[model samples]
Target: MMSTAHMASDSILAAATASMSIHSTSPNTTNSTESSISTPERPSGIDNCLIETASGRPVVPRRIVNPIAVAPMVDVTTSHFLHLCKIISPNYTLYTEMIHCNALVYHPDDLYNFFGEPWEGKVVQLGGSDPEAMAKAAKLVQDNGYKEVNVNVGCPSPRVQKGAFGAVLMKTPSSVVDIIQEMVKVGVIIPITVKCRIGVDNLDSYEYLYDFIKLVSTTTPVTHFVVHARKCWLKGLSPKQNRSVPPLKYEVVHLLAKDFPHLTITINGGFNTNEQIKEQLELVDGIMIGREVMDNPMFLAKVDAGYYNIPAEKIKSTEEVIEEFLEYVLTEHERGTPNSNAVVMAPLKMLYGGRRGKEYRRRLARAISPRTKSLPDIVRDVRLMMQEMDYGGVTTASEAEDNGGSESDSDSDLDAASHSASGCV
Candidate 1:
């Protein structure tokens, strides 16, 4: 019945505009003229509720009323997927897949093709080891209209390791400190956060993690962190194997919350069900979930009512979400968004999940594999597929694949587009 987020995102942008006057009716808002952007109440323990660095440059984390986030995934967490998730549940934070700082610094033009136009509620995650390069990329991201930025220290893929970032940097906490220090030093106004594993290789001790957080937070202004509660193996395991072989140590992250009461901590990895998420929310400031969301995005339909405690009436139903995403697909298709693989298939193939929706997904793959028809026609075909599903005896997609493991965003099933202004040619 309205724009996603009830158009609160659009109004927040006006604050960044020349007009000093803007009245925001977003959740938890009282009258204010300091800045038009309204921030959700941060988790209780932190002071002033602002995301700041050590030297005291503060940027109010805007619009996210709840700490729930769709964890960044390669090929999985596309801009279009984020758009669809927002239509279903507006309050949760969304993330882009890790873009190399070098890419952002150098290839700014191609990014929109790879990742649609930057939107509200979506945080950009940058991967790099150089402080100056990361700072430049952070500035570019802030300039492009994103509200926040996250540095990726949790990805354990070989390609990332080869780039000297990701889980490899856990071995070099000083390097992470350097990167953040340089980012905040430059004119990056948005809140810069870090996403990292608890430890890497043999540096898996709690004390090592304690020292890492202590050094980084004490030296830099970075106060918020997303910790994947698992020690990653830098060698001897493929990224997929690394995700499974490492045992999840949730208590380590819990103790981290207890120890660093001043900082905001969000726990990621090994979260699947709502009960589990609710239990962890009581322990940490937030939760970021991956694979499960990509597999069954319908889970987002309940986020407003379930996590943020909004009325059930405001939430979208499964059919409504399907319809909304289809209309969006048609719009983006006509707009000529080049990478349909990301804009279309990333969410479409798995929009419907579990045993009941397998047939719908199968039909989607078939309809999309051949790009002969217009996307509008394809959307109509999929709508018909949903209408004619015989879920009576469907053998489901693997239930065993849904286990809570470290997210491996290494598989980019999406391809960057050939040059075009919209990147959707």
Candidate 2:
């Protein structure tokens, strides 16, 4: 006999396939492009139309242009990393790491540490079960200029479970609704979304997943969801194990998208290539890539030109991208902001992944050692080392001008150094 979960899934899949077939045959739908997936008819007030603030200023619209987003990883998707990803792929949405509601409400002073330089198109992910707490956090997120606030209900870490949040909340759909309703009531103008697993522990059935999404969508204003496409064991499996041990059932997510065409559905988990992304885009509205992008940050360099059709001239070369990021770091360092070795080294690691990667990594690691004493010294040494190795055929900012590179390039380096000196005060 088929297991109950499999049976429910098969039934849902059949219905979803039938619905898709009907839609595919419609003349209006068949003529539309793959990028323009059809959403169900929403009430007029819910079409993501523009809304004005009380003071008469037009609020920034909450539009997701390309529909490709970076998944919110626990420790990896920091503000600096989000900015780096944006520098590589200008069109894709970026998400911050999962932040606790209490931290935002109680520790306002430390907020800057979590949020680096402000950039448009970044989403903030909040983890908490308290509706009031989430409401307060959403306002703080809005005030800080994040265009979207996502509720994290997909993390299966024991620490998150102990706090009565994360994947555990998947079992309690009503509470999730309360949290989202509170955020909407508190006047968050941007889109509020949820990130969740297909199921959690014993709730590993298609009906359970469907009911959860249905109830939340009907009861609240949230119309977007990023599904992880796997169930969480919630016990006996470590957080790392939870990520890999669960068998991925991407079809379930695709079926959900077909069944609820009105919702903006994005699938996350196990996607590594543009081909996989293209395949998923046919069934859903968006794709969210996680560890693969973090481990190989340059993977995003192809996203703008390849996926979004951004013109080649608009895309920066690897050398130009690194130089621009270093300029940002130098500015942060100059503002008496504590320098983060992780921030300084992230782009370097991404850049050194080419021909002489190992040697470049070894030398740059030595140059940025604790004894380097200052950000300027570290930048100077790394530039000299890269020039010596002809890494990526990149010349030092000064040497570039001397060798007939753009004058603007040399001026940028001088400006960065001057700011770095003033920051040492």
Candidate 3:
């Protein structure tokens, strides 16, 4: 069911789309299509968190209070993970893992649980270079209640490379401009942003990044840019290596802030502590915490008090928070989704991170079967472990299995990609 405002917007989208241009694929795309994309009607009444404008008109919440965001890591920043982070620190912004625009534009029906109907302010990031598809996808994101839509231009995975998007798009800023322009013109009500690397491949110079930002920001209405300080290799290096091998030159990002004072610039990469984040926030508008936060979500429990100036009493303890997430698992399981345990456990296991958490992590591994442990048992075991003051993780059932691919493959992509129309980035 479309809202009156939404139906009117789509009418404009279909009518003006004819004038849009489709440039030749930028060599990275295996195939290119200029098909007219149609948006789906999502259930309305989703703007529960929308803020009022000066004119009394409603708009999506564009200003993140502290501006700190959780980086959208595929297979990691799922809605559940973001929800967990939200519970831990309500002020820090959250993002969904980058889903290709094709998924929302083509297989919208199958993605009922993909992004989740976020009632809180959250951003959804999409991967693709097609303007019409990007616009249509943005509409769907708005329709489904995401507060913001973000374009992904930082992923260096081989699969993303083959799709002609992700880090490769850094070489095709024109395509990104076209994509964002269409999204804006299609009347997406939420703010649109881009998450990109400082540089890519041979374009690893600061001037290249500066020029890229100038071109994109000057042309599109996008005002928020998240710059991952590391430059990624589109070739030889695997995604894991790309994240580690590239030395993060954060100074380049700091210079971006110094030069472009108006744009809200966020710095990402290698930041692991509140001390590090607080130090960087003095130079940048915001800081994006990645694997470090995912590895130990408790790292964010103080975000409200430290950054947003919220009182400390409102903050929940690590034990209480994990209990809440475990409760979420129990509630979600009641819905009878086959992958409920697996899906919830994926992020839950990471709750107890680092050396002391090794024992607890091992127990969690044994708890999940091809079937699964009872929800109550999982809760009880966690309580027992914590009651005895152990929050161990990383070491697994056999000290070999769940070491994050040390003993087995981390091929969970198949499960997510099955619902992906084109693919997951």
Report lDDT per candidate. Answer: 0.65, 0.66, 0.65
User: How large an RMSD does model 2 have?
Assistant: 13.1
TM-score of each: 0.75, 0.75, 0.73
1-425 per-residue lDDT for model 1 (tens digits): 12322233233322223322233322111322222121212223434444544423243332235688888887567677778778767767888777889888888766675567677668888888888999998988887777889998888887888989887787777678778778877888788888988767655655556666766677667888999876666666667655556667777787777667678889888686778888877677888887667666656654444555665556655666667888888888878876654346456555444444444545655655455566777778777776777333211122213311222222233222110011000
Which candidate has the top score in lDDT? 2
* Tens-place lDDT digits, model 2, residues 283-319: 7788898866655566665655556666666666656
Question: In order, what is each prediction's RMSD in angstroms?
Answer: 15.4, 13.1, 12.2
In model 3, the worst 10-residue window by lDDT is: 34-43
> For model 1, which pairs clash?
53-221, 54-221, 336-424, 337-424, 338-423, 338-424
Question: Clash pairs of candidate 3?
Answer: 356-392, 357-391, 357-392, 357-393, 358-392, 358-393
TM-score winner between candidates 1 and 3: 1
* Collision count of model 1: 6
